[model samples]
Target: MGISRHATAHWEGDLKTGKGRLSTPDSGLMQDTRYAFSSRFGDEKGTNPEELIAAAHAGCFTMALSAKLAEAGHPPARLDTRADVDLSMEDGPALSRIRLKLDAEVPGIDEARFQEIANDAKENCPVSKALSAVPITLEAKLKR
Candidate 1:
């Protein structure tokens, strides 16, 4: 059977000025977390879908990279990844692009091999596959 995760969204009102709460019951990390139009479009400092997606992507990609590196006999000492989701309001708040920046410290890996493995991890990551419709770019650096 395939693994499954679920989250709940509760909204009350129209899109422009509606209030929203997101909850991840299983993990309890997000219990009735606030999300709103101002938070998404403006500077309300709450959580948004794009931000969530970015977090998920970053986490998934980093983990995948770790696994891949270990399989290749080069387990990483540290892997820092940042994911950015760009929202284009010109087309009604569509996700335009995504950028992933990864900084890694591996014991013994060459640049070419690291690049190949990083690209493979980015391509095969579950979150990346789910968000395949959006263009994704990656910048990976091997920290010395």
Candidate 2:
């Protein structure tokens, strides 16, 4: 069986000015968070889907990297990841690419090995697998 997670979004009115609330009952991390067209396509002070996607990607990649390092017997002391999701309107509104930047500090691991593990995580992480259709790039640095 597979685990399931749920989040709900409620939207009212037309697309341009319509407002919506997004919530996750299980974690309560999001409780009626607001989003709208402006929030998505403009400089509005609210959350957007792309931002959320970036957060999820960053988090998933970080965990995956840690797991990979641990399995390689070079567990990381710290792993900082930042994911950037690019949405473009070339053909239409689409996610063009995702860039993952990782700064990792792992004891007794060479830079080459750390890079190999980071690459593996970027390719095999659950989120990365799910988003395989999108172009994903990784920049991993081993911090001493």
Best by TM-score: 2
Q: Each candidate's root-mean-square deviation in Å? A: 0.8, 0.7
Kindly list the per-residue Cα lDDT of model 2 for residues 33-137, writing each as its tens digit: 999999999998889899998999999999999998999999889999999999999988999999999888899999888888899999999999989999999
List runs of model 1 lying over 4 Å from the truth: none
Candidate 2: misplaced stretches above 4 Å?
none
Residue-wise lDDT of candidate 1 within 59-117, one digit each (tens)?
A: 99999999999999999999999999999989477999999999999988999999999
User: TM-score, each model?
Assistant: 0.97, 0.97
Give residue 11's error in model 1 in angstroms: 0.5
